[model samples]
Target: MQDYSEKVQVIHNEKFGRHLVAQLDIEAGDTLVEERPLLVAPHWECGQMKCAKCLQESYVMCRSCKMFPLCMDCQGHDDFECQFFASGGPGGYICKDLLVKNYGVCALMKFLLLLEDPSTRKDCERLLETPINLDDYRDGDGMWQEHEELAVRPLMASGLLMSLTQAQSLTADDLHAYCIRIDSYSFEVTARDGDTLKGVFVCGSLPHHCVPNTVVALDEEFNLKLYAAVDLKSGEVIYNSYTNPLMGTSQRQHQLRLTRRLECSCSRCLDPTECGTNMSSVKCRECPDGYALCELSSGGDWRCSKCSAILPAADVHELLAELGGALVEAKGELQAFESLLAQYKTLLHPNHFLMLDIKQNIASILRATALMNCMDQPSKKLLARRVELCSELLPICRAVVPGISKLYAIALFEYLLSLIELVELQFSEGELNKKEYATHLKTGRLVAKEAMDLLRFEPENSSEGYLVERLAMELERIESDIAKYGR
Candidate 1:
């Protein structure tokens, strides 16, 4: 096994399989692990044409295969899969349209090719594999059938995979097991252009947490880096969230169950209020002041905190679905979002996941409008509302996402911008004197600095890293304005 990090040690257990534990006290922002992927390929749902070798957007097709897309640079590098495609395997070459739609075939081909090396095969065998029942697919049986047609059958029919399987004493079942392992362990890496790549890392797959103590980032070249999101003591387990942190407890649990096939009993998962953020709570319809909280389980019933009213699990689920559908239909429209928020304010907890979603959309719309330099009364009110929304979100983000995270950093950055704009507007209309303006500028500088600190660990080429660069320029501008006002 690769020694990916000296600060952490891999530990195995009956429950977690393989997990990482800290060896020494680690501070927030500390680099925990860094490793290049053992295997990298286009994500299963990747529809955009990309060079099979470099994963960059490309229209240039390989002359040899005439089916696989390759960049001009990669055309000269003919590998095993490339040659097999050119040879038109036992069942003939897979059509380009089929390859494009089922990108997992390409990814699976890479995995099969890697297994040709005995050492690599042995290394991969050590990774965890979850059992997959094609009949029990969450999407439906059709998805599994489609996978069989688009990904599995094509690869099995390939002459390269067949020869390798026979030579290596591998069977079709082993191929299916390898596919299961890839599905279970592969990390989705966002490329520079925002497309995703699936990467299987050896040590990187070990850590697991619902509210992760570690943040993972990938650079332009897809090199993975793990950083401590919070301080950790020696012997403490390192955790990385497999799902989005912003999701509510039930939503997170459902996603984990669907993807990883396990129920999380993590601290955050067990908390009905989700660490006191009330992200999953709703207002009790039967009581004036009560909010209903529930267990994280899908079938858990909700109980009112204030009035002790009981709400059936079915009812709660139906309400959530209705609100979710409405929110989705609202899309990006400011008026629709405001209307939805108004309609739900009395029925949902202020920090409910759906409520937050609506607020976030409202804030985004207002921010875009503010950026257009609108200074009318209604526009100013909307900008103020945006600032208020960010303020509400930042505290919740701090409670849920905690120390250095992209969500918290983004909320803080947006809050900082809104505050600066609102303050500037107030000062320009003579709502504040020079001293107050300077003070507000200094405050804005602090907020900008905090945002920078949080985003420091982001990859230099990623979107969050771009925010850091923009924040630096904004900081300089803030300082300049502050000096001018002070003079």
Candidate 2:
């Protein structure tokens, strides 16, 4: 409903194909762009029983097609799709069982339907196509076999091609190209009910950075809104991170390369200390109290900041691989994570990404235990540990992901919740006077307000958005308690 397109412009260069730049000076939190997705499809991993229309798990099937799943409320919504599925020629009816097993076929069908519209087809043509390497699939390690069986064979057997080709010509190669384009450019959006869906957007395909200057959010209908994460001067390029911000430099680079065919040399990626957070750092074996920082560039050796001891890049990679394997084997077990934390405490930096990951898992476990409403000794200990882990993570989150970040917001929320619980426990145990109780509640109110500001833009149906309402209620309760304490 609001237009911010005039505030930003798309530009092209030899280095980066297409990127957005600020047309005017923009303040932090300013809306820079808004657009709806050109195409939306269920994620490949969607469960078999999810309704084709609402994407909710349902046992009801479309009575007309008797193939596609649909709840009673969603029955009429699939009229056109149902007709096509039912009208396929002899032996052409797409088996409901097969469609359930191969969820990707439904997405391909949606793409083909969109291609039938001239304007939509033109938009799809403008998207960048990812080149397919046949050799990668030759050994059955790639998605080629899966695509052939699930997508190509099913479409060929259906009447979708006949209906779609009536207006314009299409070939098997064209379908393959469309698949690659979708894979390269689509965003994984969480739907209103938490189902994952892939969406391709025109303006959203542009900007790429390791440390993004913009944050993107999607509402219930998958309408995207991009906000400036930091203040930007006129003509400055607007960038968005394509990978997880919490990942180590090497992990982010590898994910970017694999997903987007990008080799990121962004400021964050180039800095060995990663803006002084040292998330990728390890302990220096040669010197006491020294840590080795990653050399992000190829074939560069890590050097100790205090002792100047050298560690080969290859050895660092090998060590990381071994640790990563062990972490996978831990499988979210509390004892396993404790073992990892104790074993790696002497080998890795205190804030190393791997160590942080294990701590996050531990915090999650402790948070769950603390929220169980038990005021026993073990519960209090778990609450204390949760508070401690969140305290350690908050500063690193601030250092690495400075402005309005989801990671920072969630950590802050967890920390504040733990702090509030501890305060209440202390008050109930007579550990604090009435004035102390009111003072702690006042502090919690401020923290809850901060968390509210960070989560303001989350979609109403999302888990984070739900937290906004919870924080508001929390603030009200804190205010009441503070008043009762006469502070």
Local distance difference test values of all predictions, in order = 0.77, 0.75
* Candidate 1, residue 214: lDDT: 87
Native-referenced Cα lDDT, model 1: 0.77
Task: Kindly report which residue stretches of model 1 are placed more than 4 angstroms away from their true locations once superposed.
Answer: 1-3, 63-68, 73-104, 128-146, 166-176, 295-299, 371-377
Candidate 2 at 88: error in angstroms?
7.5
User: Residue by residue across 1-487, what tens digits does model 1's lDDT show?
Assistant: 3445688887877667677889989999888888777777775555677786778788777888666688877744336556656666424524545455555577667776666545577656566343355434535444345455555666666544545653346555555556657766778877655777787886777546778888888777777888899999999988778887778987888888777666788999889989899999988988898999994464688989898788888998898999989988986999999999999999889999889889988998898898788688787788789889999998888898888878888888899899888888988999889999999899889989998998988888877788999999989989999999966
List the candidates' TM-scores in order: 0.88, 0.88
- For candidate 2, the per-residue lDDT at 407 reads 71
lDDT of 2 at 80: 50
Q: Residue 202 lDDT in model 2?
A: 66
Kindly report which residue pairs in candidate 2 clash with one another.
Answer: none
Please list the residue runs of candidate 2 whose C-alpha ends up more than 4 Å from where it truly belongs after superposition.
Answer: 1-4, 47-49, 59-68, 78-101, 128-149, 157-159, 166-173, 296-298, 459-462
